[model samples]
Every structure is written in structure tokens, then in C-alpha cells.
Target: MAYKDQKLSEEKVFKDPVHRYVHVRDRVIWDLIAAPEFQRLRRIKQLGTTNLTFHGAEHSRFNHSLGVYEIVRRIISNFENRPHWNNEERLLCLCAALLHDLGHGPFSHSFEKVFKLDHEYFTQQIIIGDTKINNILEKVSPGFSQKVADVIAKTYKDKLVVSLISSQIDADRMDYLQRDAYYTGVSYGHFDMERILRVMRPMEDQVVIKSTGMHAVEDYIMSRYQMYWQVYFHPVTRSAEVILSKILHRAKELYESDDFIFKLKPTHFISFFEGKVKLEEYLKLDESIVHYYFQLWQEEQDDILRDLCERFMNRRLFKYVEFNPNLQMKQWMELYQLFQDAGIHPEYYLVVDSSSDLPYDFYRPGEEEERLPIHLVMPDNSLKELSRHSDIVEAISGKKRTDHKLYFPKDRLDAVEDEQLKHRIIEILYGQGEVKDVR
Candidate 1:
């Protein structure tokens, strides 16, 4: 065994809820897990605001990272006696799996949207920068850190290794879907991962499933689809995300305005507001730090900031209505004016949130960021695209379904001093003024 391949005398194991036990045998993998950059993931939740919707979904990114690494470890272990599988890239796959989400900040989606930050860029920085992760990879060899970063970026020379960690049916998604489902107590993410793994074989340029495993592959696809709509794209989770984004937006606005005085200035967020956030400043944030700022902002003199923070911290999220902007443009405009006339800042109070995704896709040549299509290796040793073999997958292939909801503070509308103004808003929300699912 090489320095990178040195195995521990006794493998270490973590008791995980999703994967049962995540085993670590490689010295390098253990070292990377112990590094501070990897440790930071413990503070970042795997599914940002989904916890507010699913009380049991309190697992952190650290949990999911370990599961992913374990999956890749199992995958490579299975590939050990198989041909066309490079023994050298085994550690690279494990390292990339463990550290892929290293750059995620607190409440990733909203934080990235409001701050205009890219977790992927930060991921590259932490791996390639002069940090603990870089130092560890440097111990492996010169250019090793860059290699792992490239693997994560899906630009590595060996497409087979890249596909193992990033492709549609890779370890990352495999771990998260199962882990999230277990935590959220949802039945949707269950799939025969064992059967899928058994069918997976490394090819020269990619990993492909055997034709016999088509049913398992279809099950995995369905699990992904169910988990997306049931857990990831839950409207209530989006409500919390909306509130979180609004809170950040208000904080950023106040940070930039002269009228606001901060008893506790956002030392960590200043760089973000200035549009020049460095890696160190970005890494200094987590859910707790954000909550700390939120707690204090409730006391700030700025009513909008204070109110939004209190709502977020207290779980008083805005209510939402099914809204299609294209079909209901006039209604949306009318509601906007009503909010403004009612003294509610339409910009802050009225928001449209949309969630959309293409559940599965075949190889799309010449398109931007084209995902490597999932391929099934037939018994004859020829490969066919996933949608071609799986009817369930084909039905939703290349089809992007989107759901949009208009979010507003219902309590604010209800407390309006003007009777008729409130009546009109309520009437529009419930055509016959029948209040349903107001919460």
C-alpha cells in the first residue's frame, strides 16, 4: 500500500441513522474528516430549512458527508477485483465525497441567493487554499489537492471517478436521499441501494448499471422524484426559506443604510454586503451565528428588521397561495398594490418562490452544464440510455415541472386597521372568503 492507501490497524466506525455504520479505514480519509474544514460541515444542516417542516430532519451535513464517503468506499471496495477500475483514484473519490459540501454556509440556499455567494467556489478555495484541508492533501503529494478539487468540480481527467461521485446516481445523492428520508420519517426515499451497487460496474469513462438492475434503477429514480416533492420541495419548508431570505435581505439593507444603528454589527456579514467576501469571512458563519444575529435584531429600532427576525426566530412564517405569475399577472399586480396601499412594503412582504427540476435526463450534447446521462449496460455488453429502457424515467425525462407560491404575512394583513382593505385581500386569497390552510 502507498502512503495514501495506508489502512488503519482497526477501522473506525460512526453509528449513523441512515447508513447504519459508516466505516473509515484509510488514514488519509480519517485525516480529512478530522480537519477543521470538514468539521465545519457539522454546523451546516444538510437540508437547510427542511427541519422546520420535518422535526426529525435535524441531521447536519457532517452526517450526510460521512454516509457519502462510506458509500463511495463501499463502491470502490466492490471495484477492487474488477478490471478497468483505477486503484489510484480510490482515495480521490473518498476525499471528494467527504469534502464536496465543505463550502456550504448557514442556510445555504437563501444565504447564497442573498449574498450572491457560490458554495462551489468556496469548496474549491477550501481544498486548494492555504487551509487545513489543503495542508492534509499536500501531505499526500503535490497537485493532489487540485486533483480532489477537480474531481469535485467534475473536471477530473478520469471521467469514471468523476461519475462515481457526481453523476445522477452517484454516492452523494444516494446518501442524501436515504439519509433525509430516514430523518424526515418519509417513505419516499427507500430504494434497493444494495442491488443498485451490485449492478454498478466501472467502465473506461463512466460507471454503468447492468440491464438486469433496471428495476432497482427505476426504484431509485422514483425515490428521488418522491423525495423531491415530498421533502425537498415542501411548501412549508419554502415558507421558512422565504422568511430566512427576507430576514437576510432586511439585515443587508440595514447594514448598508445610515439610518440604522447596530448595537451588534454583523461582523461576519460585512464582507458579504460589500460584495467582496473572502473565504475566511464566509467560513466564520453557521446556523447558530445567524440565529444569534436574528435574536438581537428583534430589539433593533428598525421595525421591518425587528419584525422579520422575530417571525423567523419564533417560527411565524408567512402563509402562501398557489400562484402562477403568467396566468394570474393581473391578480398578482392587484395584490401588490393592495399590499403597498395597506402600508406593507410589497418588496419585502410580497414574494414569489418557485421550485423546479428535471427529475432525470439523457445526455444532452452542446448544452450548458450537460449532465452525463445515466446508461444501462445490457447483457450483450452494449450501453443504452436510462430513459430508453425505463418507462417511468422516460415519462418525466427532460420535463421540468415547477411550482410557484406567493408568500405574505397573513398576521400583518389580518391586523390591518382598515376593514375593507383587509376584506379585499382576504376575498382574493379565498375567492368566497373561505379561509383554508391559513397557517
Candidate 2:
């Protein structure tokens, strides 16, 4: 099978901080990026609320898409003329990487949680549906678009192609870990990509790391763990997310209430509230539209909506204190009531945020969905699951880490002139005599 007879007259290059330069040689990849659907990534932030915590993380999905594509290009270049890597899958891998996050919208996580929108479904729609992406892909072959989507969906029959971009430790992870660290100015994501790429071997159905590169693999795993805790799971980011969720919830409630009146009704959010959003409308909603509503809602009559929007916009984030959920249920409820008495809407102002994630999981038969586990190719051509040989991987695998915190507005409570009510709320938050000493 031959690829589409497409090539750029001059290779386009995007100067990226993580991958250095993203090269575009194929017309299909170029056209897909230029398509309005793909360009929408420019308006959608890569880390969503994380930008509130890490000021440098204002990068977009457009940045990550290019990074993923560059990583795949390097991987393919490394595997060229090597055994078990089909040259035919080259274009397939590149297309899959470029379009992987094409379905993401503004504030992807919060929007997905509130509106029940699946970025993956929209990704498939943009790729195989009636769109510029599909048109360009079909220029290569009638079935090429589906082939690319299958690779992204991890349903492609060729495991080699699917593994290149979708496996546990693939181009997507490799790019994001480094790219996110670079943008967020975090030291946790520094890993030896060149060494990893040099040691990468194409197996019968997947890519494997040579045994000598075990330390490099260990570094990558540790980097992922650190990046998760230090950047992705930061409490400040979660605080912003909490505020964003409440803002959306308040807006939806107002829209449903007969008493509520809007200076300008949000038509973009109407279908989302009704749960019938179309693709065109979804594409129109980037971070700009969401920010526009937030700015407008700053003057909303509903105090909860206005307050939450102002807090989110001004970076007056919720203050969090460490707490044990299992043991502190009574104290949590008492604090909620105290907040209500203090004239703060407990539903919108007081929150409990809990985040739990497994950094890495080894292959557990019948346990998990069986993540395509990373394997180390031994001298005798035998493969070993990483945890079985590396103590670091074993120590971290299957271990779920959790963080719990109680979030509330400290600035508001500080301004309270009611000494009795202020003392009560502070006592509940910090235990009896703790508040008096701190003040």
C-alpha cells in the first residue's frame, strides 16, 4: 500500500521548547493543523486550571499536539529500516499523534465534568466525520481517516502502530511530561529522551526498551510520579478547579430558575446545560468564550455566581488545610454550618477536594484493563515486566496515592467584625486554641 502522493513544497517548522522543532513534511498533517477544528486547540489550554497555579503553563493543546507529533517522528526515524517496524505505518502514526487531542475544548476537565462531553468522541468525529481533517486524510486513501482514528482509539489491528502513540510509555506521555515540565518550569520532568529513543527496539507487536536502558526507564517513571504530585495534582490547581465547577453549577442553576434574569443569555452554554451540544458550537467554545462569560458574570445579580467568578478571575483562590476525611467527618459538617452562619454560602464557598491517582501500574492479570505494560528486552531476547526487575517500579506499582484537603475563603473570614462567630469558625477550622495563638 502507498501513502497519499502528498508532500509540502517546503517543510514547515514550529519552534517548540520541549522538542526543539516540529517538522511538517506531509500535506495531510499540515492541512489538519490548518483546519478550523484543529486550530481551536489554540484557544483551549493544555493544563486547564493549572495555569492559575503555574503562571507559565499558559500553553495550549496546539503546543502539545505538535510535541506529540515530533516525538512520533523521532521514534519512527529511529525505527526506520529496523526489523518489525513497517514503513507503511509511518504516516499512520504521525496522523494519530497530531489529531490525538483534536477534540479537547476550553477548560477541558471542568467542561467534561459539568457537561459530560467526551473529547475522544469529538476527536473521532473531527477525523472521520465531515470535516477538513477527514478530507485531507481521505486524500491519502478512502480508509486512511478511519485508520488514523483507530490508532488513536487504540483499536487498530496493528499493535505496532497503536503502541507507538497509545501505550503506557509512548510518544504522547514522552512529549507531555517534558513539554509540561518545560512550560510549568518544574524540574521533575527532566529525563533522557535521547537515551530512551536510542535504546528503543521494535518488537513483534510493540516497542521495548533494551535492558541496558533500565535506569533511563526508571528515571522516566520517577519523573512521571514527581510531575503528577508536584504539578498535575497541586492543591492550588485543584482549588481553581473547585471554583470553576461552582461557577458553572451556579450559572446552570440560575438558568433553570424562573427568577433569574440575564443581561445576555449564554447561548453557547444553553445547549451544554440542556445536554445537547453540537460539534460546531463546541468548537466555537474556547477559553476565550468561557473567560468572556466569567467576566460578564462578575456583575451577575446572583451573589454566588458573581463571587465565584471574581475569585477565579482575581486569583483569590480557596485556602486549603490538610485533613483526614474518614476521621474528620463531624468537624467538616460543623465547619459547613459555621460558614453558613458567617453569611458565606457554604455550598459555593466551602469545599472538600480529594484527588487520587496511581502513578504507574504494572500488568495485573484480570486486575486492571491490563495497561500495555512496559517491557525490558534482555540479552537472551526475553522480556521482563518492569516491576519484576526494578525495585522503584515495584514499590510504586498498584499503589494508589491520595490527598484530601478542606477549602474555604480565609480572606472573607478575616474581615468579620463578629468576634464570637469569627472565633467559632476559626476554632472549627484549626481546633480550639490554635486560632488564638496564630492571631
Candidate 3:
């Protein structure tokens, strides 16, 4: 059969919790979804360690990927027949949206930090590499796979299409905000996504919002702000991420040590342990594989590895105290020594985790990742950068809010044999000594 034969006779739809239904047309997209690489997303949690805090945030990357594709599908439908919009790019946009999160491994944030792997790099690799996804896209059209990969990498010549997949307010964020809100059962992610889509207009270079939909747009900006703090940056979630990162760090240390021997071989992570991982090895990992390894590490001879593995596998995560590394250097050092003196590996036990977000921007020409600021197209065909006209977004525009929390195994700290040392540690963390950094 010819490459052009990859078009479906009927549309296929998926029932999604965030969007009622995610519709797919064309055999290329259908085949891409069935590819093993894309299906692997089903086992990787979207929020990573957030489920430890929210309990219901067990949604997978596959779930968010489909929702993003569905949003783009609707956006394209709205742009159809409109000037400056090219129907030819529709399939490319859909494929990129569906495969954007393809490279996320188990516990993505911690995994990426410990291994220094970029999920985005792996994402492009999967699209253009010798994988089933690449094969399907190539069959659709020669160079088609590269086009999808480029759109994801933000290097595609078509800025308009790239903006749809990634921008200050694009389909990816829109879908995840609402979908994450729904799964976590939090009211913060609620926003008028349908209204925002209705008001979106395809322009010469980027997608812009209609002036009339400014309120809906403001609500979106605000929704993102709340979700970041309430759900994404919640200290409890960061605690789990801290422990998870430490586990990876501890394992890597043991892997490099001549004295350390593993009771359970880290076969899947051998490449990572060597400081680099091939695409094939990276793709083999999912949340289930990580869980299996953690369970096995619980039986390891290393006290630190065994304890951390048990804590993570059993959800007995570290407890956190808010602290500023800049201002509280003395206190941080004191506690670091206290843990060490108490017979705990302070490196794994004491952790400082920070998360930050810029709610909105007013289009700085060459700075700040150059996120195309949201533009409100007025009735006179005039374009005003979002923060100028919307008071709600203007208040927080271009401002970066950051949260920091110090994580440690509280149960172990409480078991310290020295009563005076324990009292001193508690006084600095909880009493009048709290750091004044307002997130």
C-alpha cells in the first residue's frame, strides 16, 4: 500500500475525563497512538509524586496527551476556512500534540534531575528515530515525522503551528490545567477553556485571543497561578519528590562504588548508572518498573538505600519545613550536622526543593524564554499585550513566584538519642525562627 493510503474511513473517538471525547481522524494518527512508545505513557503518572498528596492524581501522561490532542483538534476545527490558517498542517499539529509527552520516564522530574536527561530531547528522538512511531509517521508522508518532531522542538518554521502546541496559553497548558484539576479534585484548575478556544484567532505568526474573551483569558491566567501553588508546588508533593530523587542519587552512588554490591541488579538503569542512557533503554522504563526496583532495593544491604526504598515504596515520605537557603545558612548547616550526628546520611535525609512559575508575561523581546505574550486583538484590529488591558493578569504579570521547602525524614529525627540536640533542631524549624521568604 502507498503512504497516502494511511487515512481512516471513519473517525475514532476516545472517552476522556477532562474532555468528554477525544476524536481522531486519519489512519496515521490511529496507528501512532497504538504504537508501543505512545502506549507506554499509560503507566507513567502525569503528576508524578503529586498523587502522594492528592490521592486521586493517578492520571497518566497518556491521559493528558490525548486531552492536549483533543484541544488542538478543536482549535484547528475553529481555524478551518479562516484566512492565515492552512488545513495542510492539521495532521502535523495533531500528531505532535499526541506524541509530545512520549519520552517522560517514571517519576519524570526526579528521574530527569538525577540522570540529567531531557525528556524533550528523547521526545524528538522517538519521533524521528527507528521506532514504531517514526515508522507510522514516515508512512503517512516522507519527512512527515521530522515535521511533527520539529513542531515539538519549537524549531518548525511555522510559528503559528508551533504556538498551538507550546505558548504562554496553548493547548498543552489548557488541557493539563483542567485535566489535572479534575483528577486532583481541586477547584483551582477550573477555567473557561471552551470560551478561550472560541475566542482564539489564527494570525500571521501566532494564535491570539479576541478582545471580548479577555475575562475568560484572565480566569485562565489566574487558574494557572492557583493550580501551581495549591497542587503543583504543595510541600507534601515536594516531599515525595525529594525522597524519590534521593533514592536515585543513592543508587547511582552505590553503582559507582567499588565496595557496594547490589542484591537486585539494576539492569534497566545500567546505562543511566554509566552517566548516559540510549533511547531504547530510556523507553523501557515506566512507573511500574521503578516500583519493582524500589521494592527490591528494600532488601539491599545498604542501610540508606534500603530505608529510602521502603519509605518510597510504602508512601512513608519525608516531612518538610519551609526554609530559605540564602538567609538560613547557619540553621541549615546546624540541622545538617544534627542529622549526621544522629547517625543519618544527611545527604539523603536533608533536602531543599524549590519550584517557581511566571503566571503571565508582557512580551519581553529577547528575554525570559521568549514566550510569545498573550495578545488581545481589539475590534479595530489592534493588538494589545495581555497584561496591559487585563487588570487581573496585570497584577502578577512578569512576576516569578517561588516556593522552597526543606525535606527530612521526621520520624528518624524524632528518634534521636540526644534530647537536647532534638530540642534545638525543633526550635529552629518551627518556632519564632521561621524564614520570612513569602512564596
Task: Please provide TM-scores, in order, for all candidate models, with all chains considered together.
Answer: 0.94, 0.93, 0.94
What is the C-alpha local distance difference test score of each model?
0.85, 0.84, 0.85
Model 1 pairs in collision: none
- Colliding pairs, model 2: none
lDDT of each residue in 107-158, candidate 3, tens digit only: 8778878888888999999999999999999878899999999999999999
**Any runs in candidate 3 off by more than 4 Å, and if so which?**
1-6, 357-369, 398-400, 431-439
Can you write out model 2's per-residue Cα lDDT over 118-224, one digit (the tens) per residue? 88998998888888888889989889999999999989998988888877788988988898999899889889999999999999888999999999989998888
Error of 2 at 273 (Å): 1.0
Pairs of colliding residues, candidate 3: 8-27
lDDT of 1: 0.85
**Which runs in model 2 stand beyond 4 Å of their true positions?**
1-3, 357-369, 398-400, 416-418, 432-439
